[model samples]
Target: MTITTLNGVTLAYDDIAPPGGAQRTVLLLHGFASNRAEGWKRTGWYTAFERRGTRVIALDQRGHGESVKSHDPADYGRQNLAADALALLDHLGVGRCDVFGYSMGTRTAMQLALDAPDRVSNLVLGGVGGKLFDPPRPGAAEAMAQAMGTDDPETIENDFLKSFRHFADEQGEDRKALAASSAAVSPPLDRAALGRLPMPVLVVAGARDDLAGDPAELAAVFPYGKGKSLPGCDHFSAIPHGALKAAVLDFLDGIPDEDDFPPFE
Candidate 1:
């Protein structure tokens, strides 16, 4: 793990280097509340990228993992998060790289491309779409808020377990940090800005995603983006193991086809 100061905040990240000949670099961002370790490492994404001779860097976004955490949810806004990520790349002396993000991380990547198109060579978004900001499901925000306000650790633990036990359990090393961070990044994303991003994109969602938009609607938002729904899966299940691997590989490789293109207006 490496730590760096980006925009006055300390960020934690991991860099994995493949053997011998490495061709390209990829920056992997995990979802809200999850750190880079569980997002990429435990999921075998790092290993997969490594085997393909790609150098992958995974970041623990502000308020998650080992990075800085804040009680203020406003600090986790998309614009601020995006700048922090770009600064991390600059600090590492990386000119540009492929960006892959899942869930909340996916939203961050999309915003990054919009903010610094020149630095993003390719974009891959998983488990989210532009529709999330269109007023959350009835009572959903209230529900999460109520759960978060509980002073009882048992209740908080139960809600967290129900919401993400599979991934949360795997994140034993940074569970508390991640939980705090996820809380900060929450309330989902703001959709109005997402609809206008023109970056070349790849949007992947689970076929049965309970929280995201339908594939067709999601694909329509980007003039150059395509949508792929993993077969027989839901939001979280869509990303584990085989379901997401091939789609990600295909998307990354396809970026070269649009290497010289400009974002659609």
Candidate 2:
């Protein structure tokens, strides 16, 4: 793990290469309250992409993992975090690469693509669905923050927050930091803005994942985006499943081709 200052905040990241090196790389961003390890390494995504001859780089977003933890809500937002991704790429002298994000990471990845369209060749967003296009409302983060702020997980009323409380406990995350992270002021993205993304994109979600919104509906917003659902999986269990891996690999391999697109009138 290497640490660097991005916009005056310390960020921890990992830049791992494949066996014979790779002509391309994928920058990965994990979901909220989660770090690179749980989202990528622990889920076997690191090995999956590496095996396909692509390098992997994952960052512990500001308040999560080993990155700088701040108690201020202003420090964590979509734009602020997106800048961190750009700084990391610049630090490594990377011009352009594929971006892969899961859950909350998908938002950050979207901002990255929008902010620096030239720096992104394509995007792979997982654990997300149609809800992204909807207005941002009070999400589970605040509830989860309060839930984790307390040591007793049994008191957590929300099933989603309860699962995260378990994960935070298992990973020994700093509860205070996570709580602050959850409280951070993150604004929702404009649905119309996504139409400006000038690259191909893939959105994957589990069939049973209500948290992901509607994958088919979400994919329809992007000019070249496609949606795929992993049958019989949910929000938490979707990424680590084999279906996600297969979907990602096939997309990168360009299996569908232009012929696969619905004919234009």
Q: Give the top-scoring candidate (lDDT).
A: 2
Q: Stretches of candidate 1 above 4 Å error?
A: 149-161, 165-199, 255-265
Q: Write the per-residue lDDT of candidate 1 for residues 177-230, one digit (tens) a residue.
A: 444444444434435555565556788888778677665567567667777777
Candidate 1 backbone collisions, by pair: 33-182, 63-181
Give each model's whole-structure lDDT.
0.72, 0.86
TM for candidate 1 is: 0.81
Off by over 4 Å in 2: 136-141, 257-265
RMSD of each: 5.5, 2.6
TM-score of the candidate numbered 2? 0.93
In model 2, where is the ten-residue run with the lowest total lDDT? Answer: 133-142
Residue 48 CA error for candidate 2 (Å)?
1.4
Clashes of each: 2, 2
